[model samples]
Target: MRCLYLWVIIALFLMTTCPSAHADEAVATQSFWAGLSTKAKFQGEVVSNLVGGLASGSVGNALFIGGFSWDSERAGEWHGGKVVINFLAVDTGNPEAYVGDIQGVSNLTTVDSLMRLYRLYYRQRWGQVTERLGLLNANDYFDNAGVACDLLNASFGIVPVLSQNLQGMPTYPFSSLGSMVALGGGDTTLQAGVFGADAVHPWQQPFSQGVLMML
Candidate 1:
């Protein structure tokens, strides 16, 4: 519950490396994995629970997320097809039990510590329009905030209201089956999608419930 917001904080502080596109092009055709552009990040943080209660002790958490993408156009003449995959892992202490902080420390921290497949989807682009299907995270396409990263609060990663109200709305750490359509110009854009309302892991009973639409 309160442990959910921590993941967004980690996303705000993610670190990465840069490589030449030409360099990757040189090796992309050499191997299957070679064509996949992969990114990995690690994050850690601790939150203090002052004046909350006797259990208001400091707690910490760590996160590991790795993601990779394969461009069908880059792989060959496969046109506008692309595949993406991601993995997220989090470990956290029971700080809420002590401090009763509802906001949580790191968005990724959960009561249970386990690694899971984060996002896996296929997307196709035609000019400015794009279509995506399969396991999806709505947060990847809608209402994203850059300023939220500058602060420690998790609600900054995604809109706090949507994050709290949406039932499934595939998002960070967990994804649900869904699809999205994007049409845009230089300034204004329209994007919408439907995602499973169930927050459970996609690998387990993924389609057992009604779907929720994101507009």
Candidate 2:
């Protein structure tokens, strides 16, 4: 784990010091997509087993996400409203699939070969409250801890109670037609959302067979 942390520092150092390695690619991409309301991020990692569990091998995963946000005020559509559409492509395989581990090796390998429309939602902000509707993920809005997400364990990222009990609460790699409402001020905030739930989600079925009430 220390090695992984060291590697991260070294990689960041290289990215800052070795600008020549990626300068051309960055310039080319920027020039090609000069005037656009879109941004893309590429994130991936390969986690190799260093000790005890899950075999002495490696599993790799990558997530490439691209999104376009349209501002209602700028686009002259409506005031205080914005629409964002995102696409996520996940290429991954779990190490636990081959050799079982209690906590798994990496969070990236949790889902594999998934190409989906991750989030396509419209949010309207009015005063101190914001309302979001459309295809969305629950993890995007609820039960988030900034520091706990720093670790590599998947268990640390999500709530164990919700993950264990909720059938389909509009989370990662998949989403449902849900509405999220957030209210409050600087120090205190309250968030609540309603989503569709089923034994199997209807991302494939497309709302034909699911109940739209998950508390």
Clashing pairs in 1: 5-107, 6-106, 6-107, 6-108, 7-106, 7-107, 7-108, 55-98, 56-98, 168-197
In the range 76-101, model 2's lDDT, one tens digit per residue, is: 44567878899888898777754576
For each candidate, what is the lDDT? 0.73, 0.70
Which candidate comes out best when scored by TM-score?
1
Off by over 4 Å in 2: 1-36, 97-99, 147-151, 198-215
Give the total clashing residue pairs for model 2. 1
**Against the correct fold, how does model 1 do in TM-score?**
0.74
Clashes of each: 10, 1
Assess every candidate by TM-score.
0.74, 0.71
Candidate 1 C-alpha lDDT tens digits along 1-215: 45566776555545222235556665665655545698798988877777756565687888888999988776665677889998889887666677655665456557677788887889998888988998887777777764565336664677657666765656666688888888875677788898877756565676677777877
Task: Judge candidate 1 at residue 81 and give its lDDT.
Answer: 83
